[model samples]
Target: MRMPEAVTPAEWNKAHEELMAKEKELTRAQDRLAAERRRQPGVRIDAEHGFTGEGGRFSLVDLFEGRRQLIVYHFMFAPGSKRPCSGCSMFVDNLGDPAHLNARDTTLAVVSRAPYPEIAAVREQRGWTVPWYSSFGDGFNEEMGVTVDDNDSFGLSVFIRDDTSVYRTYFTRGRGVEKLGTNWSLLDLTPLGRQETWEDSPEGVPQESPYAWWRLRDEYGD
Candidate 1:
């Protein structure tokens, strides 16, 4: 297997220093982008949809769990399908404790078109404790554009609320969701860069379409 070139310790340090400069530049750019995102206009939500989950029924605003900001991970599990998207499973597996995000006034949740019973079974089997709610019979997923043409698609949505008004602040999907995972974020720093089919990697490096190899966390073979 071809590996990156070996260099003397001094040379390596110098290279690292140069890369650190670029890394810092990227960090500043990311900060600026985040600031810009915070200022982006939000779309006010007027319709109400019911959701069923842990404590029973809830509305979109209730999903915020009393927090000012709500981040919902749109899981691709359809109402009657036993096939849960392996990519969505992996993404949820990578999430750390939500308490840290809660400390900053944000609540993270998962919303899917699957019935609550199905959601409960998957959560129990996979040991996921995040607050996931069912959008079944509510048209919430369809309204959010994740259930377009009656097909399930995965994404993330951000919302902010006032006393009685809720507005969607942001949304992301595909590669935009990749940065949320430590595994993907670390891989992004490597030369091969996740080795995904869509990435512009060097010739001969291993590559596959995203989710081609994803599996439920516990289903991975040793």
Candidate 2:
């Protein structure tokens, strides 16, 4: 990375204040976007969907755990695979705690096509405490648009429960999934900023091939 020229505190503060104004504007724009997202109309899901978990068979409605809202992370763990997608694993590893979400009447869980036994084994191996379930044979992943051509894909879907009815509020995939990773958010504040080739960093800033640094939290050194 190219080193920034040294400057006096007064000069640095002037530049910092200028950036702060743009940052505040961006924050307001994001808030407006979130408000619009909540205002968007949602579609009701009527078809019965089942999942297998440690607690036994569960229906889609049961996933809310009596909460008003549910967020499902579509984990890319194909049936019989020894390891899940590294990107998915990295995204999930940053989900620090669910209690904060639960406090807001939102429940988050990971869903995959892998069998419960395989899901459980990986959960144990990764030391993750978040709720996870298997959508094998139920077509939940496909119905949710998280599986295409029999290949598992990463996605985040939001649902709302009202009385006996459930509606899908929002869904996103691909790079949109980056919002769930705290690592990227942290890196964006640094000089190099994630070191991805696609980033709009200054010329001569160091960057690595995308996904080269990705590894499961437990297998970081391996």
Candidate 3:
């Protein structure tokens, strides 16, 4: 690897302080972005949508579980698939307990096109306590733009409920979902910073093939 130059403690502290200034600026910029996101207008969800969870059938509004806000993670698990998407699994592995989000009057859940039985199998195997539901036989996935041509795709959608009505506040897909994964945030703190081929790491820095390290939580070390 292209190692950093050997420096005295005083020089190292000086460099660290210089980087801290830019880091603080970046933090403020991120806060502004979040504020802007909250201000964006949303659309009313008037049509009914169905989902099957551990407790049987439910509507989209029911998924909110009486919370004012809901965040649904569209996991890419199509019908008849042997397993869930590795990427989605890895993303969910970093999810924290939901009580904190629930405390904020928000509910979080995952939805997939896979059958309830299949969804339950994986959830149990992974020991995930998060709520998950199946949208099979329902156009919810397609209507939400998370399914295309019989293929499932990843997405994160936010909704707000007012009285008896619900509205979609925001929807993000593809790389936009990265921010939800704490794994990436933790990696960003390391000198190698994800160590993916797309990263601008110094020459000779260790990097594995992209997605090579991905494995189901239970599949690793086996």
RMSD of each: 13.2, 13.2, 13.3
lDDT of each: 0.77, 0.76, 0.77
lDDT of 1 by residue, 29-56 (tens): 7644554565567889889889999989
Ranked by lDDT, top first: 1, 3, 2
What is the C-alpha lDDT profile of model 3 across 1-222, one tens digit per residue?
Answer: 899999999999999999999999997775445545655667898778889999889998899889677888899999999878999998888897665455445677999999999999999999998899999998989888988888778988888787778888788888878776554432332233445675555566457777766555445431
TM-score of 2: 0.80
Measured on C-alpha atoms, candidate 1 has an lDDT of 0.77
> What number of backbone clashes does candidate 3 have, counting pairs of residues 3 or more apart or in separate chains?
0
- Best-to-worst order by TM-score is 1, 2, 3
Q: Which runs in model 1 stand beyond 4 Å of their true positions?
A: 181-222
lDDT of 3: 0.77
Tens-digit lDDT track of model 2 for 163-211: 7698887888898788764444323322334456655555665567777
State the weakest 10-residue window (summed lDDT) of model 3.
Answer: 184-193
TM-score, cand. 3: 0.79
Question: How well does candidate 1 score on lDDT at residue 21?
Answer: 100
- Tell me the TM-score of each prediction against the true structure: 0.80, 0.80, 0.79
